[model samples]
Structures are given as structure tokens and as C-alpha cells.
Target: MNVETTVADSSLLRQRAFVAFWLARTCSSFGFQMFSVAVSWQIYSLTNSALALGMIGLMQFLPSVLLALPAGHLADQFDRRRIVICAQLIEWGALLALVLLTLFSWTDKTALWGLVFVLAVAKALEGPAMTSMLPSLVPPAILARATAANAVGGEAAVIVGPTLGGFLYVAGPDVVYSVSAAFYLLSLVLIGRIRYTRPQQPRLPASLSTLFAGIHFIRARKDVLGVISLDLFAVLLGGATALLPIFAKDILHTGPWGLGMLRGAPSIGALLVGLWLSRNKLEKNVGMIMFGSVAGFGVATLIFALSSQLWLSLLALAALGGFDMVSMVIRGSLVQLDTPDDMRGRVNAVNAIFINTSNQLGEFESGVLAAFMGAVPAAVLGGVGTLVVVGVWMVLFPHLRRRQKLENEAAQE
Candidate 1:
């Protein structure tokens, strides 16, 4: 069989809508990461409570659970561009509020909680709309390339944002918040320039029935469900990010600069892998690659847990990031390729819920476990748990392993 090439057509790369959307997304992500670091640092300084830091994750997750279904329905019913613009505006407003609270010297714990909760609401509104707009900006044939490019852009932000935020924090937290607000406003303007023909909406009831449609769609596709479950469990167990502050201060014996490197290392690894995969098609068995990469991630986490040397731990994180990127690109491409265009919004909404929930749940679990046992034990247990998930998924979803064979056979037909 001939190899399926993955390089995107040069002309599509020059398309105005795709370029505009990409720029807007990349800029927005940079600002978002900066704010994330600033908020976590501020809350920890003010309250000195791990549970409070965990609450920040919970605030974001709860809104995604409650609003994602409705937000998906709105994406289907309204103009996606407008939905994105409005969400950006809300984000800008939240940032501005944060800035004012800082300016007025209202830096109390209650005020910080209010700021986090408002930001959570904004993220819940934005997440589904942003994801559902992807297919509309580029054709289906180059969707994988687009996904890779998108990941690269986000990872770039991750590289720059945290490093910048850490430096700015030495000046003041207010500087970080103000800079983030400015970026959000700029992103809003950039998004307004994209001009794509919005698809016509399908007439559907505005009821619980329509929301359940997304669940039904996922239930029928064994391959899609398998990939999602793999990601959900792997991330839930292997995520040690919520404990980074503890590691940075206690184990690494470094300051905020070290924290920035720890946060940015994985994204750097992910960026490198994304760039490489964008050029080469996945002609091999993708299922094996996905599971193998995830297992590799678990091993990397174990290395990170045991290492005393800071540089060695950074190397381990970089490897984990690269493996995680491979899993993400494979699963994301499968989801987009399998779903019908009309159902993309709801399907993506379901994906958002699962992915975001796993992140927060992992954070909460890590925090609780760290408080009870210790950071080292919590990190070690999380890695062990990920290995168990990999074993369970391999036995439960044999079809995922057969996915490449199925694709090759279809191409021959």
C-alpha cells in the first residue's frame, strides 16, 4: 500500500481564516498561561492552603460540566465566530476585574476566590466554541496537520508565558494580570478578522433530548470511546502538575524561575514532537503507538518521581510531554475524522468535559493524597495507577489495536 502523506498543502496554510484563527488562539493561550501562574501563586501566598489551590481547579471544572452541553448546543445554533468573540470579551472583563481588585488593594482571600470563579465561568463558555470551530477553518484532509499546528502554537505559548509570568511576579502580580488583560483584548480583535462561511444549523429541540444526542453518538463508536477512555484514565493518574509548587520548593530547592522551567519543559517536548509528526503520516498501527506512548509517559513520571537532580527531572518531564503529544494528536485526529460535520459541536463538547474533568480531578486527587501521605508517595502512586489503566484498556478495547488494519483494508477496497 502507498504511504498516506501528512504534509498540508501550502495553499491551505496561506488561507486567511486559518491564519487569523491560529494567531488569535496562540496569543490568547500565552496570556491565559501567564494568568494561570499568577493566580495560583497569589492564592497560595494569601491563604497558604493546598485545598484552596485545589478549589481553583474545581471551580473551573464544575462550570465546564454544567455549561459545556448548553455551550455546544449554542455553537450549533449560532454563529461560531460571534460565540468566540463574546467569550473573549467575557475573558477580558474578568481580567479587568482582577486588575481593579489589585489596584484597589483589595487583595483578600474572598476577593481572589471571586476572581477565580469568574474566570472559570468565562473558560466554560469559551472551551466548546473554540474547539467546534476548527473543522470550519480548514478542510478535512489536512485536519491532522491543522491539529499539529494548533498544538505547536499552544506549546509555544506555554514556553513563553510561564517564564514571563514568573519574572513579572517579582515586579508585582498586578503587572501579570494587566498584561493578560491586554492580550485578551488583542485576541478579540484578531478573531474578528476571520471570515468563514458559517454552516446552516440543523433544527433541533432545545431540550435535554438534544444534549443526550452527543452521548448517544459516542456510545455507538467503540473506537472513539476507547481513545477517550484511554486519555481520561491516563491523565487522571499520571498528572503531577498540581504538586509542582511542592516539588519546586522542597525537592528542587529553587524559586519561581525553577517553577517556570518545570511548567514549561513538557510543552517544549510536546512542541518538538508536534513539529515532527506534522510532516510524517501515521502509516503504522496507531493504536499500539497511542498505548505505548502513554505507557512511556507513565515511565517518565516514575523517573521524575525518583530523581533528585533537577536537570534529570526536567529531562523526564520533556519525555513525558513528547509522549503525551503523540497520544493527543492520534486521538484528536480520530475523533474529528469519525464524527459527522453536523455533530462536531456536541462531540467536541463531550470531549471537553471528559478531558477537563480528568485534569481537575487529577489535581484534586494529588492534593488530597499529598496532604495525607506525602508528595513523593502521591507522585509514585499516580504513576503506578497509570500503568494499571493501560493494562485495563488493552484488554477492554481490542478494536483500537485493529484500527490501522481496518484503515488499510478500507484503502485497498
Candidate 2:
């Protein structure tokens, strides 16, 4: 086992395809983050309406909700790499258009929204293809570590992208858009360099059943269902981070600087932990560890909710982020490792919907609950609810709770 692990660890470091994929994924993240900052600023500058800003999110979210399953089906039936490339190509074209329009002073709020929607549509199609490709790039033994490494790239991009965009925007919106487009071009080129053995899958006809195969696949696998749903409910209940602004302004009596630091705490924590996990392995009692990490996340959320001190709140938020990272890495690795290659795209699509919707809805849930009660109580309730969910899920999915490895079912077959 030690020899095997040594080989796996080395394989991860030397895997060329995975390396390209990681670089491509990181470039894509940087572009997306830069584009987000540019578009938001441009939209608000044009309309100066908060409603218009809200509509941007609505437009972006609508496509994922509507197209994710179809996108999944497409991933299953075609070259996953090509699908990702095509989606990013579309995004790159949109960014180019944005650059031209902004340069000419021809872009309006409506045009911006339309462009944002197009980008979102491409993202919806790209997400599942990108996610489902990871398991094929490296040995299953290192998938969790690879996932952590992937996340570290994203975390680094998130920390840097917006600030970079903001600085470039000083030159103008067009400059930011131009730089973002360049990143997408790099991502496309890197993706083109990736090589993988595509499994021979039967050409499944398009039908309701085919489109929804991922749902059925997940439902039949109790372990997969448990992991997916546990994340959904736990995140849905533990979205107290959404109340940061409220806490900063009303409770903590601080300025935007404080809010910025508060907002950044979680990402910093996640990034540090991700770096560690990338070098280390989670080789034993993974299921229990995942559950415990989630419970720890809840405990951190509860502490953050109750804390009146800024330092303590930041610490709690950071802890929650670290815990959440552990859970995310475990859950993602397990699902991908256990799934068949033919069904991976569709399954990941369903998983994407769960992840995306849970985050958006979790924030929405916290805001609504905060409106009814108060930020503190709402956050406290969310933390407690997350803990309750962890307990319930452990009871409900005994097999998942006792699971010990991240072995690839397809490889064994």
C-alpha cells in the first residue's frame, strides 16, 4: 500500500494531462472573476439601478437552472473536451464583443445584460464537462488531492482576479474585458493540449430518460445521494456568511475595509487548507472525516454568529471555510471516483445544479430569515440547522457514514 501510494503521489505530480487541465481551469477562473468585476461595475455605472444589478445575477442563474441537464446530456454524447472548448470559445467571443462595444461607447445596460446571459449560458454548458473530466486525468488514488489542488488555483484566482480587474478598469472597462479575453484564449489553448482516452460509449438516443439519467444514477447509489444531499442541506443551512454585511455595518460597527477582510477570511482559510491537502492524502476513514468536517463547519458558523468581537468572528469564519474545504474535497472525490465514465458528465451536471442552486438559495434563505428575525438569530438558526442535517444524514446513510476509501468503481470493473 505504501508503494502504491508513493506511485500515485508521483503520478499526480507528473501527470501532463492533469497539469494542462489545471492550468486551463485556473486561467478560466481568472477570466471569469475578472469579467464578473468588470461587468458588475459597468452595469451599475450605466444604469445606476440596484434592480438592474440584481437582474444580472438572475440572468446568469436562469441558464444553469434550465440548461444544466441538457448540457450534461451533450457531455455524455460528445467529446467532453470539445464541449468545454466550445463553451469557452463562446465566452471568449462575448468578451471580445464587450471590449469592442465598450471601446466604442456603444454598450448599454441592456447590451451588458444580454452579454452576461450569453456568458452564463456558456458557463452552464462548460461546468459539467469540466467537472467530469477530472477523474480521467489522474489515478483515483490521488483524485482527492488533485481536487484540492484544483481548488487552490480557484482560490488564488478569486483572491487576485477582482483586484486585478479593478486596477485594469482604471484604464477602462474595455481594458479589463480585453485582459479577460486573453485569459480565455490561453485556457482554450491549454485545453487543446490535454490528451485522454475517451471510453467507447454507445450513442445513446436523446430522450427524457437519457437527459435525466444522472438523476436516476445518483438516486440508485445511496452513497452518492447521501454525499450530494448532505452538501446541499448543510450549505443551505449554514449560509451565515451572507449576513457579513449586516454584521459589519450594524453589529460590528465597522467600514468597508472591515467587511472586505471579513469577506476574505474564508477564502484565505480554504486556500491554506487546500494547499495542505494537495500535498497530503486522505487515505483512511474518509466518510467519517467528511461528516466531522461538516459538523465543524457548523460549529464555526455558530461561533461566528454569536461573536460580537471582529477577531473572533474572523477566526470562526476562517475555520468554517477550512472545514467546508475538507468536506468539498471528500464529497467531490467520492462522487467522481465511484461513477462510471459514461455517466460521469450527466452525474456531475446534476451535482453542479445541486452545488450552484444550494449556494444561491442558501444566501437567499439567510437573507429572508434575517428579514424575519435578525442576522444573529438567523445565522444561529442556520448553524444549528446544519448540525441537525449532519446528524440526520449520518443516520440516513449508514453505508456512506462507514465508507473507507475513494476507489474508482470503473477501474475495478
- Tens digits of per-residue lDDT, candidate 1, 1-413, equal 33333244434544677888888898899889999989889989988999989788777667889988888777777777788899888888888888888778888777777777777787777776787777777766667777888899999988889779989989888899999988888889888987756568667877987886777888888777888888998888887877888988999898988887887789889999999877767776888888888988998888888777789889989999999998898889888777766777788888888998898788889899989999988999998899888888888887786567213133211
Expressed as tens digits, the lDDT of each residue in 1-413 for candidate 2 is 69999988767655988999999999999999999999999999888999999999999999998999999998888899999999999999999999999989999999999999999999999988899889888878899999999999999999899999999999999999999999999999999988866787888888999999999999988889999999999989999999999999998888999999899999999999999999999988888999999999999999999998899999998999899999999999999988888999899999999998999999999999999999999999999999999999999998787888877432220
Cα displacement (Å) at residue 146, model 2: 0.6
Query: Against the hidden true structure, what lDDT does model 2 obtain?
Result: 0.92
Candidate 2: worst 10 consecutive residues by lDDT? 404-413
The residue pairs found clashing in candidate 2 are none
TM-score, every prediction: 0.85, 0.96
Candidate 2 wrongly placed segments (more than 4 Å): 1-14, 408-413
Steric collisions counted per model = 0, 0
